[model samples]
Target: MKVVSRIINVVLVIVVLCSLVAAIGSAITKEPMLLTVIRSNSMHPVWERGDMVIIENLKEEKTIHKEDIIFFKTEEGSLSKQGWIAHRVMSGSREEGFITKGDANKYTDQSSDGTVPIKQEWVAGKAITIGETPIVIPKIGYLSLWAEKFQSNPLLIPVIALVLAGLIAFGEIKFTKKRKKKSQGMELQLIYIVGGLTIAVIMGGTMLTSGQNLGLAYQVSDKSQGVIMGSDVGILKVGDKVSRPLSELSNNGAFPLIGTINTSDKQIELSHERVILSKGEQIKSTYTVKAEIPGKYESSIRVGLFYPFLPASLIYFLSEQSYWLALVSVSLVPGLPLMVYPFVNGKMRRKTAKLLRRKKRKIQSSLPF
Candidate 1:
């Protein structure tokens, strides 16, 4: 048993080291790809919470397998945006994009255009082994969520990273205290972990409260004065703030007008076409967007970012397997965590276990095991 434990310890250490290396390697080896922890059980038995996947765009002609883990773009917002989802490829032709279904679900994601065709180019790389073990990275989702707050304001990333690293280090402390009842202790530990996850969901939502429900960020391609895009909006002129698609423009609702915002010294600029002017007329001005929408989640949600469908399909898929329905159903929002404290507490507890034990002793001096 001692030998086995030593092996386990060695294994754990190797796992931690390798996971760290893979994470860093993934970050630096490719054009930086965001590490998305799978929150839904869809890709399950294969992917679970805490699994860290290194996503890199697949090169042209890379052969895809029937079950090779892949991520694809969906026009159906409920499924995923290019920036939004990480799921599994169920079926498809290289000539046609593969049909993708969450492992938890029964069917594939059906594109409105038709069965989605994954040309050789759209695949994100397969998830190699996680850390030193074969486990997936769902456990890391909580950490990724916490780490994101730092990304919003890069100044805080290092501080956040240090705190997270410290927490991870703390969880690694040797177990010095013996439990009076191992089963009860383990149950409490499991409950605590789940509780923490619930809190994390709440916190993720809370952070959304301050930011606009919708956010728009894109760059103007130098080649075109105008272009077709997802959101259709009228350009704001100096005095024409609320024009429909902005004065003499069609509101197709898919393409937002393209422009540049120069707020360098707070010198605002507004550019717009004349409301009634002919096609050849040029209109330009400086107009600062006042009272920006207070959340980007809705924009992403409507467009399928904070998707509830992934989780919904996952839950349903776990219970049953209605493939095509699941595919079409991937178009709605999924339930999100409403609390973040529990997850935070889990990390805190792991980090401070030794410290907590010290405090407990002062209160239990008379107790004899």
Candidate 2:
């Protein structure tokens, strides 16, 4: 019984440490780690609300076979408030993208106005599986979902921090009174404090630096005259093609990013399909829209941004072959360091402590006593 209890305690500690590492890594790297919560019954029998899904980052291995379940960012104005959706690929190709539908849903997502076919650039990751079955922890994500609400409240964080600090101080005082000896308790406390700060920073930063939804609104008029107005708002007659400069895309972040521009309609042609931008650089390209059957039509250009961890040329080439491949390759950069650092750091610390103790013993033995 004691051994079983000890094993459970060890497991819990490891889980807590891993969660802290993921939180801090995500904040520093501006990328998501491998876990996500299922918020609805869309997945139904396979995965329901309050279940935790383990995601395999597609940035390294970008192959998406038919029937593979993928996690992707939803298009602008989607019904989901979380801005992401996970669904199974029903059918499609890499060049044209894939059609996706939830297991419990009656129709494909593209049947609605808000979601289009699942594009490669929009895909973040896929569900990790074992021979056709996805791995999920049932009902464990309820706590996470409950805590998620507090993320939006700015004042709550500081209050929570103060309460935690007070509690830690009280515990330390009591422990000191009970036993007056130096131990590793201080180090563990420091780790806990740092972990809390990491969670706070990640939650706050993501809320502030969230992605912007930029789109174009055009009116396809029936008038015989073709009078092209503004870039965002334009009026075009049937069978006429007009070119207009699109909104400038700027990279203010520290890393270099590759942006792929995609349009809703087939008639829209961009001057540049893919663009690379370094820090503090910006680019503006023109898009030519060829009006077909005239009516009040709305068209949107979705730009997918990717951090170019690999060589820009390689990323470009991979994107041409498969956008999913390019995305998967670059995403490995942030997560690799986070996963490897804990073990490496622990090993180094152990070695250093052993050396210090050996040196101390040598000094004591050589002393004239």
Candidate 3:
């Protein structure tokens, strides 16, 4: 019984440490190093909704080949809204671009105006697999999906932390009763655990509340003058331009953040490409859409939230290059300090204490009292 309990405790501690590492790594790299929940049945037999899969970022594995399952961003003019999709590579090459298809779909994503050939720059990451089989944790992702719905709530992280702390305290009470002499060590362990949890909560909360996709659906026709029916959807004629306010962007987290607005389409223009917000701040901005061609169009605006520790010039340059890179750089502001603290502070304190003890012993011996 005691051995089984020990094993369980070890497993729980390892899980907590790994969770902290993953949260910090994703923040610093701007690439997800944790499990992503499957949201659809497109992969069906391989893995379906509610299953979780791990991915390796494209930066780590630049060479993609046929039959590899990759996660990529959907093109602006594609049938589906601009978002991420995970599919298997069917054919094509780096120069020509690759063809992708869902495992259960009859046609390629490029077929019938679904999407253009998959560009190299569009790929985000590839699903991790072992010998043609993906590592899947079944049904566990439902918890994550459920948690996502409450991400906007400011109290969510605090509520969760409180619950976890209560559980830990209860366990400690039982353990201390059986081993009173080890109470001090257990208290130290509890402090470390709580501190790690706090960091993880802050990182997770910031990432979750930072960004969202805002889209505009409109039509261009030669017969009528341009008119915006609502904030997002509208009608326009060739050479016409219409502007409207986008949904308000809010910073619900406890810290200040930099929000950058970006678009893949040339016809769309934002009044403010970047805005900085303090805690609980909200801002509304407008975007103009130009009609160059006669057709229905959908434009997606990507808002990425980043920590504001980097220089404004550097942040602007990096944001222009890639939002992910800017995010990665900003994340290091907090992550690097946390990572270096233990090694620097703990070692220095230990060495200082040792020197002080040695000097005291020499002084006592010389006095011969």
Candidate 4:
């Protein structure tokens, strides 16, 4: 077990070192923007989906020559699902921006401003290809894609994390007993209990947060076909004490603005309106509310988790999507207890060995006599 623990620790260290190197490289050369797995066939023939390509930031390489495969961000709210894009430079200069086109595509990404030029600020990095063929680590990209899909389910990650931690804690107890030739002491048991409790509390909080359906609930008072002045119909949860910011609803010139209405104002009568929220459109509102009673309560005021709320969904999704990276991080956690156990009990172990050695010496002395 000790030998296995040592090996695992070494492997974790190597993984961490490799990650640091990649991140540092990205920061320095901006080339090989870390390890980005291709998700589309737009760069097919040269690169394909499931292929991981290295990107180098254009900042490091000063020159942006034609035919260079560069990655850049799209215009804000362009609606392109691909957050960042990589394409070959077809025309234009680096001073202003460069015109880019995907090798597999027939038409350029031109807009009203002629060929849409990717500004210097948008250029992420250039792909480091060998002889027109970008280095491809095939099949591994599928793992990343799968992780991303699984991460979308909010509950999956937190549950899995807690389970993994529980398993590690159980394994550690057994291993420690085996090594020490006895059960762990009260101090060590207490430490394990505290750790377990901490994990439990955190997981419980995350679960509660995910299930909380807090949103805007509003109604028209005058009925003059005016915009909903206060809260829009949505899901919201009221928490005891403190306040949090909820979604912001814009009139957008579509609805007539009657006036500003709020529950806190005490002048407006807030009513609950059942609204089937538009999926994927979680609104960010400036309004905040404090619920004296915690539960699903409908009110005109938007309620949010109290200030300093953890972004449970975002955290869980990222952890699940970056499964490989998360595993590497978790591997380190298990190794810590294993390594520390030996150090913490080293004196006792050494004393036991010394006492056994002395007993053997005494028996040998008696036999000679």
The residue-by-residue lDDT of candidate 2 on 1-369, one tens digit each, is 969998997876655444444443443333445766677899889999977778887773487889899887765436445566889999987678889888999999888777667778778888999999999867666655655544333334445555655565576567656653344423433444454554444333323222222455566767765444544446667878778886576666555667766665777888877787777787886788788766655566544456554676776676666544655555444334333343357753564466669778999999998
Error of 2 at 44 (Å): 2.5
- Listed per candidate, the RMSD to the true structure in angstroms reads 18.0, 13.9, 11.1, 15.3
Per-residue lDDT of candidate 3, residues 1-369 (tens digit): 979998997866654444444444444444455556677888888899877778887863398999998887755446457366788999988788888888988988888464678888778788889999988767656655555544465445545555655665576577656765423332434343455445445644455345656767788888885556653547777888878886577776666667788887788889878788788998888888888888877777767766556766687778788766776566544444433443356753464466669778989999956
What tens-digit string does per-residue lDDT give for candidate 1 at 1-369? Answer: 969998997866554444434433333332224354555666777767656665545566677767666655555445444443455666777787676666677766564335455545545555444452333444645554454453234234224334543553355353323323332333344434443343333323322211111233222222322323544432222332221221222211122211111122122223431122122332333233322322111111000111122454352442234322332333212111212233356654564575568668866986775
Error of 4 at 160 (Å): 2.8
Query: Of the candidates shown, which would achieve the greatest lDDT relative to the real structure?
Result: 3
Range of the 10 consecutive residues with the lowest summed lDDT in candidate 1: 297-306
Ranking by TM-score: 3, 2, 4, 1
Which pairs of residues clash in candidate 3, taking residues 3 or more apart in a chain or in different chains?
none
Model number with the top TM-score: 3
The alpha-carbon deviation from the true structure for residue 53 of candidate 2, after best TM-score superposition, in angstroms, is 2.4
TM-score of each predicted structure versus truth: 0.36, 0.49, 0.54, 0.43
Residue 88 CA error for candidate 2 (Å)? Answer: 0.9
Question: lDDT (0-100) at residue 219 of candidate 4?
Answer: 32
Q: Candidate 3: global Cα-lDDT?
A: 0.68
Q: Report the error of model 2 at residue 152, Å.
A: 2.3
The TM-score measured for candidate 4 stands at 0.43
